[model samples]
Target: MASGNMTRQPSPPRVFVDVDVQRDFCDETGALYVKGSPNALFRRLTEHAVARGIPIVGSVDSHAWDAWEFGSNDMPAPEGGKPGFPDHCVKGTPGWLKVEGTLPPRFRFIPNVPHAPIDTAVRELATGQTHGVYFEKEVYSLFANSVAEGFLRELSAALGGAPEFVVYGVATDYCVRAAALGLVQRGYRTTLLTDAVAGITEAGVAAALGEMQAAGVALTTASAVLG
Candidate 1:
């Protein structure tokens, strides 16, 4: 039996996962803009995370100009028969960049590659050597990047356990929904900042919220999170 005086180790700080808050999705004039993106709220959330020294793990939709996912491309869809979306977030384009106030001063971009250095990433994230770590994804789901899961697993181990995740960003129906569901499926305690996200359509957002809630993702607002 353990001694009564023994103390339990403190849990790690909650992680803020910003999902695909790029200019194309947030800016009104950009391609594939999400309606009603709360740019001010996004800034506040990012600033709060940085000020509190919380780790920020985020995803960016980085596509090639001629990628199959672009509806302008003639290539066939990989799986479903559905056509692709309008060209958006093409690499090196203005719209591909992250929205203002969403990035930290000290952050690293991890490209989608077969041999990502997961160990190095975990160390940097867990030690606060990097305030934010952003993963590049070609598809709506960050999990589409093969290295993402491995990096996340190692980070969890380094942090002593799986940390609670607070998720936000553009397109509540697509990327944000995929991210929140992915986190919950991996047994992470996930929360979605409802007011901070926008969506392609009202119906989509409503359906996404229901799915997320059913999957054990807590839905709340930025104010609640900040408080």
Candidate 2:
């Protein structure tokens, strides 16, 4: 028996965090394509989320022509001066665009700028007017965008609680790993869809999985998640 005055509590949010699933990483002809990555699986995940009305948060590597991370540049690499990567995902390029079906019809792109205002971003997302929210990043981690953390925090509060993040995307060893670990570190319950992600090498993927598992990120497959 229920009391007439009793009210139901709002359910905690569950969001899908799509990490760097752009043409450069997932398509065969792109500059930095990850060979043997299950790109179709990425599309399936996105479709499922849209059908279920789950919020989709994503990141894109929006680099410049002479960005320091490019191997063509003489500037030091982001990771301890190591050699940089081949040119890929340059701003306004075809390869920088999100793969077909991964982007929602109603989406907002958050630029990577210092001290960007987050109030409007949070309101737009929390109000259900925007189905997808994307963060343009200059580095492997979306956290590199100054407003990302603040936007997420405020979005969580607006939605009543922190989200349980379902993460999947390209290059399991890099952006996916960073996003998963960062979410967990920021007190979100994060889960990685293993089968849906593609990596540069088997060794790198295995190492990344181990590291993610050690840091309390749960791992599963697309089949498990979508089913």
Among these predictions, the greatest lDDT belongs to 1
* lDDT against the true structure, each candidate: 0.85, 0.83
Q: Mind giving the per-residue lDDT tens digits that candidate 1 earns over 36-71?
A: 989988888887776666778999999888878777
Q: What TM-score fits each model?
A: 0.92, 0.91
Summed backbone clashes in each candidate are 0, 0
lDDT of each residue in 1-227, candidate 2, tens digit only: 21233232236767889999899988889999998768788788877766666678899999889888788878776567644789999989999998887887778888898987768767766765666799999888979888898888888887788677889997899999999999999998999988888898899999999999999999888899788
lDDT of 2: 0.83
Error of 2 at 150 (Å): 0.8
- Model 2 — TM-score against the truth? 0.91
Off by over 4 Å in 2: 1-10, 78-82
Which of the numbered candidates is closest to the native, going by highest TM-score?
1
Worst 10 residues of 1 by lDDT: 1-10
Q: What count of clashes does model 2 give?
A: 0
